[model samples]
Target: MHLNRRHFLGTGIAASALLTAPTVWGQAKPKVVVIGGGAGGATAARYLAKDSGGAIEVTLVEANPVYTTCFFSNLYLGGFRDFESLQHNYDKLAGGGVTVINDMATGVDRAAKTVTLAGGQVLPYDRLVLSPGIDFKDGSVPGWSLDAAEKMPHAYKAGPQTQLLKKMVEEMPEGGVFAMIAPPNPYRCPPGPYERISMIAHVLKQKNPTAKIIVADPKEKFSKQALFEEGWNKHYAGMVEWIGPDFGGGKVEVRPDAMEVVIDGEVTKVDCCNVIPGQMAGKIAALAGVTDDSGWAPVDPATMKAKADENVWVLGDSSAQGDMPKSGFSANSQAKVAAMTIRGELTGSKTFPAKYSNTCWSLIAPDDGVKVGASYEPTPEKIASVESFISETGEDAALRKATYEESLGWYAGITADMFG
Candidate 1:
């Protein structure tokens, strides 16, 4: 098979052209590439694969082979739940006919409608769904970077850092202080830091009764504040202390290795510090040219289509969801809406009306739980809320316990919806 250089080059071009060409009108199916395999991307991939009925090809790109959900991660820290309970596999997505690629997306070529994988493979797409979730804004806090996270665990995204933080808390001396610095608003899992405090307090009350937990927050008010306060008073009174934006004097600065936190012009040292910084859409979103100054992608509320790029859609915490809070439940709901819209566009059918819903649950103790939620309908410009589902501040033990149980059930159901 000795061929001239010219002939070899000609053959290569022809093969490349054939591979990139769209399948025959009725014979070839449209291809969709979904980035990220968290709640939003996984759900979108599953629905697109299943509902397309072989009419659409779905490929999902994720950096990790397995996903550990942020939902219920606090329970893991409190020793109420194990890591296995939060772990999920993408086998179901593969089984559903989606090509699950265990790789990170490097970039997106919107004009050509292609996704570049970290492995240097280019996947062409008729439509692309980006759900890369949250990325911490580097230097959002001076001296806080990925390197600093090694010493002071944010545990915000969950996984190894989360476990490390739990270990640090367990090893702290009695009466030692555990300081937590919360991020600004619009971060992933808005109620997460408060839930974390409750869970850590749960562990501390048992392991080191004299140990104190301090929250140095950037915001004046927090999600489920009254409920968390009530639970703290009932179960771990005097063990938990909150320094809101005002009381903290201002935003706190973190010193990871030294385990130091500066609040209201006062410097304090702690045994452990969990500093969660402000977050934005992942880097791939920026590379795709979909993000604005806020570091989030703006999208059409009705279709989930990117405001900047028509063929691309953004979902999850990475998307500017208008009225929707950034939570796992919101991501799951948005995924379904986006999936339906993408399918309709591919099939030449009318887009369905969009509706969104979310419920974020936080546990103050093993049995004490609280939640805030909302249901929304699409308006001409954006999604608007029509109803709310929120937990009252004061609740009986039995109701709180029931809510905790319900949170577990919701986690199971939502994970099933995403990856089962």
Candidate 2:
């Protein structure tokens, strides 16, 4: 069956609906410390508190008061969503009796199982859940680093970078070149840069119809390539160009100061450049000693618990689970399993068998959306895909529109799931 948000979330398939524990007033509640406020952490934190009914003391340590989801950020550029709509607060989670802290977690002492914050407070955890999102690999892109972000924004993390990239695209001179250096594989949002290109094209197609987009991608093929290419051709013909590694797309560099893109040693001046370098798990996961040499935390596929420490669980973009893409939906799915397992271990709560699912939706144009998804069962080896589905290339307009509408509902439902 094609699982929509209603069936996926409402049916308790995404998370266990009955996560109850016998609450005791005289007892010390088990404490769960969740780091990062993205899909994984937020969902885990919310579910831990909401279901535990005061049996688990959930303290969420997030650096930001408002979370700007990277999922729907592309729509903001396409004029489909406003900036404020992408931002969500912890009000619902707080109302559910969760202690939400806004502070950076600087270090983790694994032996002590304590997280040290930037503000000098050390938090102890019976269970530590780290769902910190992706962080760029230093020097992954030639001549591009975090310092050069202002000149050539990656916009990968959302928030100010998203707004900056939008402003840069809007302010570009007519017919100017909008260049993008796509990240390599194993990056966040497999089809993100492409969808971003489409959204940017959507904006430029209307405001700066003469603007040109050049994509230098390391991979020859991308997720939903046919769908995106078809839409680009049908909607924004002659306005977009994609260069793959076969065409020296991989041997590319950016000169942020000069606002230029060097493709295969050939220099081209660009009005705006979006440089997305290779990525790895966020810094906190590495600090916690949960991540492997690959910079992603390896976890037991069955429980989403890090192999390094059973007391710790990793979720979202930081986890090296198999098959599932590093998407918000996947993270949210994984968070539920992790949360339930932790609750069972800590509070002796009712536990359910682990089931996971994910779907990634990309909008190629206004009301034109495509998606790929799968349901999973965890083996000792990996979280393997048992069933899968994708939008067909020749799908009708009504289907595409419906897919887009489904994505919107998913956004609404998922945000409610995470923060509430």
Candidate 3:
């Protein structure tokens, strides 16, 4: 059942009619419009469509026809994983009676409760869920823009850019410098940049021993700092160099074709560069007038309901959930809680206060992994941590290998839960 534009709209109308039936009086099927189809949005769509049992209408809008995860993308660059393994289809959501629209969302009319797409179609919704993810804070690097990203790939989003970076690395000359400009704190995947450097270093050691990897970071410390430093020392001594903010090697200013990173008032050029700029909520969140000065939507921790508008719910990277990191796992977990809250609110049932969980994994090498996780609950002043699941610095080689394997298993299970 290929749901073209016409069929999708028709199904939505039909679902609306069923809710208005006399026999089902007082029972209104809440119309849910999800603005992104990545981990968070896809999980929410599947759960709402399946759990509602036709009692709720689920419509998902995504710009891309398929999704490629940022997780494990470093392995792709290291030539350890294939691109196809990271791709996911939306068949499960469609089969479960979800109205999937493969189109970019242009705006969201919160007052009118309608979403405007790039094609000029408006989707009316009784309740809106936005998980559009993050967008780079352009100009954080003086001359860095979308155009410049083509030449100097950030590879942060894990798609075409990842391929471009891999190709560049493969073609670079021996003894060439592969520079990576790391972003500051409070960004997606806190440990991602370090993990990328580790993977790239692994390749450099194997393929081009003369090649050098440099990380120019704005922060003094990072995720799994001690672990990553220990691995670098034990494995690739003197092959990788990290310049912290104090070393004057981390400030970045973008040029038209290159990035100018100032370190101690001196500049060093590179053969290829990966500059990960700062990030904020996606465009759709801004369109809905839910974002504030921080460029992220604020939501009530207890309900995941937008503080700007009651009918709207924001989760994932786009929403400012107190103290929660912008991670896929956190987003997926929050979506489940959001779904339950929405269902209870519409059905006049008891609503439970929302709780969120997050676990982030970073691989130091092909068979070495480290993780940090926490669970949170709402408090009178803010959301507070309830428990921690932090992995220790030292572990047996077999344990690290098992963790790496488990990470892959987790990816498969989460992807299946979202898109089947």
lDDT for each residue of candidate 1 in 1-420, tens digit (9 for 90 to 100): 223533664575666567755343333467899999998999999999998887898999998898999888998999999988888989988998999999989988888677888887888788999999999988776557889987888898879999999999999998999988788888988888888888999899999999998888878887777777888898898988888776862457777777788887788989998878889998899999999999999999887888999899999999986888888899899999999999998977566778899999888887787888999887777778889977887767898889889988998899999996
Q: What is the lDDT of residue 161 in candidate 2?
A: 98
Off by over 4 Å in 2: 1-27
Q: Is candidate 1 or candidate 2 better by lDDT?
A: 2
Question: Highest lDDT among the candidates is held by which one?
Answer: 2
Which portions of model 1 miss their true places by more than 4 Å? 1-27
lDDT string, candidate 2, 207-283, tens digits: 99999999999997998898899989988999999999999999998898989899999999999999999999999
Local error of candidate 1 at residue 373 (angstroms) = 1.1
Per-model TM-score on C-alpha atoms: 0.93, 0.93, 0.92
TM-score of candidate 1 against the unseen true structure: 0.93
lDDT of each model, Cα atoms only?
Answer: 0.86, 0.91, 0.82
How does model 2 fare in lDDT?
0.91
Q: How accurate is candidate 3 locally (lDDT)?
A: 0.82
RMSD per candidate (Å) reads 3.8, 8.9, 3.8
